[model samples]
Target: MTTQTQPIQAYSLPTPNGQKVHVMLEELGVPWVYHRIDIGKGEQFAPDFLAISPNNKIPAIVDPEGPGGEPISIFESGAILKYLGLKFGQLYPTDPRQQVKVDEWLFWQVGGFGPMLGQNNHFTLYAPEKIPYAIKRYGEETLRLFRVLNTQLEGRDYIAGDYSIADIASIGWAQSWERYGATRAEHPNVIAWIERLNARPAVARGLAFGKAS
Candidate 1:
């Protein structure tokens, strides 16, 4: 296991993507320090933040105790989660087949669920002028993605057959279903899954981080 005298430096806000890393660190019981990169103030574009996160995103990290005991900077929420999981020998399974299952759902969330819902939010809430076509297009897509998740949870307690990073990757976005025009009535399984995750102390703390301060 990786040991560190210094906590991992997390540059992030409390957005859905940022919550993923927060939840993972909390779940793993690892030491980490938060550095808020206020996206609202365009802090992500600053040269220092951009150096690690070339895509100019809020959630990034610098690990002083990385492999070979050398410092390393990492960006992207999914990659960060994978790194932490592997380092701690937790959440992320070692068996090839089990790991593949986790990857499938993890990618599914990052690729389809998060992006489509983000677009829906952009056009529905943030667009200066609401275009009916754009709103309808993204709204429909959001519901479709929610249905996919609901179906996946039919007979399961969590995504990917266990409580892994797949759950961490999705819970942040899934909890905001109402924002994207989804109803719990239509996603009963998803709602139950959300409740199950929220019951965990680490998840509740992670999801609520930065809100009080």
Candidate 2:
């Protein structure tokens, strides 16, 4: 009989970036422990947290025994989601073409949508003081990203085959853009997609930190 791997211990927060792992774990229906690493006050920079996530980012995890029983620690929210989805064979496709489609959307979030909107939040709302040019630059770019998403999602329900890694990767961040004063109304498709994602019971629980006591 094949041996089972040791479960991972997750270190995370409720932020969109942090929630990727949370949602993926929920989707995977795995048993794990949560270590809430609060980045608001720089808790992630703590040496111990850094060990699991060298970048000191939330949404990192340590698999007690990975592959050949070696401890596996990883950062990067997108990578984490892909790993879990592929391992579980639940939220991602094993077929090459479908897998690539899922991966494309996942990477889009990490490189395009997430960063652009994050900057939009910074200059448009989070900056100590607003600079018109900065706000305009990021805000327009954020909308453009949304438009790209809207176009891609126009005839699709989920980003890839059924509800795969694409949906899991995008959900968390889409829910929080408004907190940064980033609006989605203009991108009607994105708005509809966000509603659908958060509507999932697993996603709802993940957003609330999953069975908090």
Best by TM-score: 1
Model 2 clash pairs are none
Candidate 1 clash pair list: none
Candidate 2's TM-score: 0.89
lDDT of 2 by residue, 137-182 (tens): 8878876776777788787777765887788777876776565444
- Each model's lDDT comes to 0.91, 0.77
Q: Model 1, residue 64: displacement in angstroms?
A: 0.4
* RMSD from true fold, candidate 1: 1.2
Off by over 4 Å in 2: 1-6, 176-185, 210-213
Per-residue lDDT value at 51 in model 2:
81
Candidate 1, residues 14-75: lDDT per residue as tens digits? Answer: 88999999899899888899999888789999999999999999699999998888999999
- For lDDT, the strongest prediction is 1
Clashes found in each candidate (C-alpha, N, C closer than 3 A):
0, 0
TM-score of 1: 0.96
